[model samples]
Target: MAWYATPGGLSSLSAPQLAAARRSYDLWSSGNPGLASKYSFDSYVEYAQQRHAESVAETAEQEED
Candidate 1:
């Protein structure tokens, strides 16, 4: 029912979606620090890193099971 619940949606993401998202955000910020400053850079980076770590952990747990 939910978009993300769909098989296609789940399959659309690569194995390392969080890494990809982090890289994209980093690139954007590097190119436009002023625009990035419009956001809370420290909080954004912290959240991104936390989410990436969680994703990696979850993937590892899934593989173990």
Candidate 2:
């Protein structure tokens, strides 16, 4: 588990997780008004989690090859 320092306090999310969520927001937040309105931090966090899993799987595959 990784911890990050926030303005309020420490967050359970790692630096990479936070970075991924921010990138996810930047990609999706401004495109569709409807989607943007419905999207939230929780959604971004989910995306980040999926993205991390995919990345890990990809790396494992590459190592196997």
Provide the clashing-pair count of each candidate structure: 0, 0
lDDT score, candidate 2, position 57: 81
Tens-digit lDDT string for candidate 2 (1-65)? 32112221214566675776567576777776687788786665565556666777899999999
- The 0-to-1 C-alpha lDDT of every candidate, in the order given, reads 0.57, 0.59
lDDT of 1 by residue, 1-65 (tens): 22222233224445575455457668978998997888554455555555666777899999999
* TM-score result, candidate 1: 0.43
Quick one: best lDDT, which candidate? Answer: 2
Error of 2 at 10 (Å): 11
Which 10 consecutive residues of model 1 have the lowest summed lDDT? 1-10
How far residue 40's Cα lies from its native spot in candidate 1, in Å, is 0.6
Q: Judged by TM-score, which candidate is best?
A: 2
Q: Candidate 1: which pairs clash?
A: none
